[model samples]
Target chain A: MTAPLLEARGLRVTRIGDAGPLKVLDGADFTLERGEVVDVLGPSGSGKTTLLRALAWMLPDAEGELWLDGSAAAEIGARVWRTRVALAPQRTALFPGTVADNLLAPWRLKVRHDAAGPDSGALRRALDSVGLDDVALDRDAAKLSVGQAARVALVRVGLTRPDVLLLDEPDASLDGDSAAQVASAVARFAETGAVVRVRHQRPDGTATRRERLVAGRIHGVGDCE
Target chain B: MSEAAGVVTIEWPQLLLAAGFMVVVGVISLRLALGLERDLALATARTYVQLFVLGLVLRWMFGIDSPWLVLAILVLMVAAAARTIVRRAPDAPKGMLGSSFVSMALTGFIVTFAVTGLVVQVEPWYRAQYVVPIAGMVLGNSMNGIALALERTFADLDARADELLALVALGASPWEAAAPSVRTALTAALIPTINSMAAAGVVFIPGMMTGQILAGADPMKASAYQIVVMLMVSAATALGSVLAVLLTYHRRFSASGVFIERGLRDDIATARAEE
Candidate 1:
């Protein structure tokens, strides 16, 4: 049997409070199989985003056991693990350069040295997947509108082609049409047996499995269809 | 006793006249209700007592011909400077005191020795008169530079954590993610030294040059010494600030190329505690 793409057991996160340690995610357990879209629904101040970040290994203080692609996350090096599991944060932060530079920024990393730069055709396709035209690639990424920046961020992360994508409120800044485009783009990206976990206020009907988070714990899970 | 060849002594009456001028300034502050009268009085008293004690200490240090004693004093100065920097820059990270101490000690000793031993050719190479003052100048300036660099780099990284994490998510190394903030901090830390270098002769006379002139040194020779001192100071400040920032920047991120949010939060907590 093939192992799940990502699995977490007894994960917990805490922040230092004036009184004591404040628990953010308490014993949050989850599993994601290939070709699955998991939507974690919660209102504001819930632990939806924190859970996603913990799964991405972005929270150093997080405590739990995480397995990625049948290997213990602790056994896998962080740089390699991150390449397989990427987190596209809620707020889109663009570098101080053109969209082409922002999109190609990942290729400049040492880990991607063996991989060649994405061709123009691939770049155009990635942008087109997110409702952005080829012309958007040359514009200044920093000057893009909030919605445009969010889409650019999505495209940028999508081009990395990770096995699992953890998106935190990807549609929070997007309009209805753009949100639809993002949903479809995510679906296309996940069609290759990759797992996509999204944190949203409400399920967008694209998720195969829906989980509700309340006060730092998962309450229930059900099929979205 | 008559004034020595290179010594200019201030008589008691002259010192009293200076004290009277300070009293006049205090009175003026009080009359104007600037709310500085108490601070002015306390500061004047502290300055008087500290300088008097420093004079005695310097005299004792100069009387001793041992290089070990001079080294001991220099170590003490570096430790004091490091503590001052840590206190001044409350936003500095956890290990900042150690980093600042090492940076200041290394840069301060190198530059001071270069000036006293090579440039000025002081007789014993560790003469308290020359080495002590030069080392003090280098340590003091480099301390400020290191503090500024550490504080600015940490604060900037914390503020732009999202930008940094984005790079990390793209498989960039921790160094690559933090390069922008480090560059900004280094530039900021060196600006004061650069400005001082630019305005050295044109803007105003520096304290060291003025002291040499008042102590009966030739004006041209004093100006030359001042130039060398300024160069050493500029070099030390740059080196110290860069070293401190590089050492402290890595602590802002974990080994996994993730920004240590707790590190930034701890820095804020430390700043509040200091306040």
Candidate 2:
């Protein structure tokens, strides 16, 4: 395989506890092809979110190196890598603004490429796809319900159109219906070949691969089936 | 006592009439305050009553001519005010309450000494007439300033924490996240004193200068004291406000540099938690 779109190797995370260094993630390796949607399943403390943060070039305290295609995350050029890799946390942290502004915030970031506001047709299509109306674009984002905010967060990231999107438990807070909507948004983004990474806890509280999160550390990549 | 030395026999009748007018102002202010349903009025009246009693005590303190007696009064005033400020700081750490008081009083003293001792150069720095009033003005104003600064600092640190975390996740250091709100709180806490100084004589003559004049100080002397007091307040208010924010922001970030759960939160949680 000629270097996947995103690659992670030798990732480890530990925190100092009363006893000693409590290892959270030990040598987790990950790779993603263009447009692959990988569901990560792990126990509560198996460091799933930590892995995503490490890949995103965040988690300053955690020791990891991420290669976006060929260049190291550190050397990949901050603006370039940021445009390519975006993280949408599960909480849907949207700012205080109109829904349209929330949908277009990443464009304001110097790293973003989508300077032209979401085309009116694309805006309507995206909103309609997510079961929102054109009127929602004019509503104050601060007054949005959690479900609305979650959708708005997805729409904003979609507007950015990153290469590898790290979504840590993106649907954790939503109800069944809201979770389905969020999952649908993720699936649509996945169709465009952006690597979508997600984490979930298993029934037995042990690490399992919902997709390929079980590959390097626990060696259970085929378990998602 | 002699008319020849230009010490004209003081007119007690006129002085009594003047005192009665001041008393009337205080009383009518009290009535208006109550009529307006301002709870601050009762507290203001209570303060007035305390000051009236303080006047009686000071008269005896001056008669004794003992530094120890006068020193005792100053300490009592500082302690009481410090307690009040500390009590007002509901969210401040258990350890900071005493330190906040002592530190604010110390800030006031440093500023007061600079004005009266160095600039104004009263004969003795501790002369009760100058030292007491100057110290009283400095500490009193600073108590308000520091109270606001401290309260705002702690409250801000604990609230708006999501913003702090957002900045952190966005590659800002923890201190950087707190810098915006900390700056905001510090400025808010200092504004009352600053605005009063900025609009002095234009908005309303400061009560201290007016009181000094009514108490028989020369108008020029009263103005001088007022200027010094205002300058000292400006310096002390900044000092107290900065110290307050700096110390409060210290607890906002964790050892791991993460914005801790409640460590940097504002009042939002408490309100929600109460609910």
Candidate 3:
């Protein structure tokens, strides 16, 4: 499918513990088409995080060859690679500045900021789309709750309109309604024809594709979708 | 007593007073480490032994002066300070020790020499009396500043790895991503030294001053030395912190500039006092 928007091959993540190298992501391969959501299901200790991170081209320590869109990971600059694939980390990370400050985030960057930053109108539209309004722009990004902040982050990433959104357990910390909101936003992104997102799930939660990670391997890509 | 021997011999009394002060500090500090009493006791003993030994060496080097000996002592002081930083910042990046050593050496030498050679101009430029104390003060304070700075920077990095990763993904340079977080910590950690410098006079007199007065220096002269000491500390603290933090980036992060938590041993409650 047009070489997929994102591709990862032979990805492995390791952490040096007292014992030895603890392999986390072992030989995981994933190809992401435009606007598809590939939920990565795994029990605790599975390599869900490592796999999602690899797809974002942000896993510096993970062993893998990641390609973005049709370009090889090594061939593209980080700014270009990132602009194409944005990661909505499960952890709510708001820039230390104000709400408006975070909304205007890309404007601070020398490379991606110049090309990707939308004007004020564009930013307002993105925030409004994410159910945020002009009032949130002035608030301290650090002060928001997980759900509110996550939505704001979604809006922020949407400003860039990445070709592939790498979301790691994006549904976490949200109430039923917020989870639906987060899911809908993600669904909207996928519908726009971006590449796949390797999403992690809270236990007993539901998604279109249920793939469990056992011993660092994706054992089930079955008909759960 | 002869009229010719009209000297106040309170040497023992004076030394006892200083010993009393040490006891007071030890007693107070013990409370904080009550949970680990054995470790605390050992650390206290080690500190006493180390400081007393340092006192003897300083006494000799300051008196029977040899330039080579003085320089050697200064080098030893820098080395000791670097080692202290390594012990203090166990959780930092791997090259943290070497980074602390080199950067502290560079900054300490520059500031201490500049103050002695140009600012204060001790004629020999390496007088043990001046150089030793200056080295001790500068090296000691700089080492502390670096340790605090390094610890704060890396801890912030650990907690905010996701933020850092996001920034990196956005094509932000590795330095750019880590710099702000590191800078926040570096600035906060430097405040103690800065506060000391700011409060040198009105708030309280420093240890060097109190020591000089007890050793029979004129109060005015002691004050002068202190002013110079505070200046030296200020310069060394800033330079040392900035350099050590900048150099640490190389050791603590992966090729993609990801922070390696195992980069160094920062949680030194283990080394400081074993369970």
Candidate 4:
């Protein structure tokens, strides 16, 4: 059998505060296989976002053994590992430029030197897949509405073609219709053998697996569809 | 008057006139409710005592013709300057003080030595008069640059944590992720030096030029010295600011290229604890 695309064992995250250190994630274990969509449901402040960030290797202090493509996380160079396992954060973080500029940003990174950016046609198709029109490429990214910016971020990450995508509330700002469009886009991406993990308020009806996070631990693990 | 001889002499009576002017300013400040009288008095006292001690020390330095003494004094100045810089960025990571000291010392020594030994070619290379004053100017200005750069870099990183992490998630190395903030900090640190250089001739006569002229040097020669001093200062500021940012930027990230938010939080916490 093929190895899981991403795996984490005994993952723990701590956040130091003025009051003292807070244990945000407690020995959370997870695994993602190709073409699987895992939905993590949690209430506010339940360390859902923290779990996503820790899996992306963006957390400052985390204790766990993580493997990507069967290689130890520590052995994989950070840039190389992140290029294959991308995280779209909760807040829409776009540069001060046109949407096209933001879309082209990941290509400018040194780790992407071996890979060329999508052509104009491919860019337009990626935008359309996320319910965005081609006109968004030229529009100022800063002027985009929160929902539009979130879609742009999703599309941008999709353009990178990462093997594992960790999305934190990718539809938090969207309306029902727009949220469905984003879910469909994610579903299409997952069809191409990419593993996806999303932190969401409720199931979007696309997840194959569902887990609820409560007080820094995963409480339930079951099949969704 | 001989060119080497001092042209202006200030006797006790003349000095008293300057003190009277300060008192007048203090009285006006009181009338305006500026609440500067106490601070003014304290500053005036500090200026008097510090300059008086400095004058005696300079006299002794002039009498001693040892290069080691000059080196020792410069080292001491760099140490004090590094301490001041570190104090400015209380939120910086641990070992920032040591890193800043090395940066300031390296930049300070390079620029001061270049000016005194190479440009001015002062006999004995480390003449107390030339090396002392030049090193003072270099260390003092470079200290300000390093402090401003460090403070700005840390604050910017903290404020833009999300943006920085987003860049990292996009496959950026820690250095690449911090490029914008580092550029901003370096620019902020160098603006003062750049502005001073631009305004030196038109806005005002700088202290070094005025001092040279009052000491009976030719005005054109004094201007030349001032120009060189300004250039050296700008170079030192640029070097120090860049070094400071480069040295401290890596501390913001982990070996796995993750931005260490906890490290920064811990640093700020430690600073607060100390305070």
**Which has the greatest lDDT?**
4
Which lDDT tens digits does candidate 3 get at residues A108-170? 776654465667777676766655654456788878877788888777776677787777666
Instruction: Summarize candidate 4's per-residue lDDT along B159-259 as a digit string, tens digits.
Output: 77878778899999988888888988999999999999989989999999998888899889998888888899889999988998898888878777877
For residue B78, give model 4's deviation from the true position in Å. Answer: 0.3
RMSD of each: 3.5, 9.5, 6.0, 2.8
Name the candidate that leads on TM-score: 4
> Which stretches in model 4 have alpha-carbon errors above 4 Å?
A16-21, A194-200, B1-6, B262-264, B267-275
- DockQ value for model 4: 0.58
lDDT of 2 by residue, B1-275 (tens): 12133223447596566556556666776777745324444655676578779788767666666667656766777787778777888876655656665666678668877877898887755667666777777778777887887788768766765554444443345565577677878888878877888899888878887776656667677688788778887888888667755765665454434555452133323323544
Docking class of 4: medium
**Per-model CA lDDT versus the true structure:** 0.83, 0.65, 0.71, 0.84
- lDDT by residue for model 2 over A43-137, one digit each (tens)? 66566766776676655355666887787877875446655777676666666578777666555544344456676677767877765664467
By lDDT, the candidates rank as 4, 1, 3, 2
lDDT of 1 by residue, B74-193 (tens): 999999988988887776567778888888888999999999999999998889999999998988889888888888888888888789878887777889888899999899999999
lDDT of 3 by residue, B3-105 (tens): 2333355575785676676666667768676455556557666876898798798788778878899877777777788888878866675556677889888
Give the docking tier of candidate 3. Answer: acceptable
Report the TM-score of the second chain of model 2 against its true counterpart: 0.73
Any idea what lDDT model 3 has?
0.71
C-alpha positional error of residue B170 in candidate 2 after TM-score superposition, expressed in Å: 5.4
Better of 1 and 4 by TM-score: 4
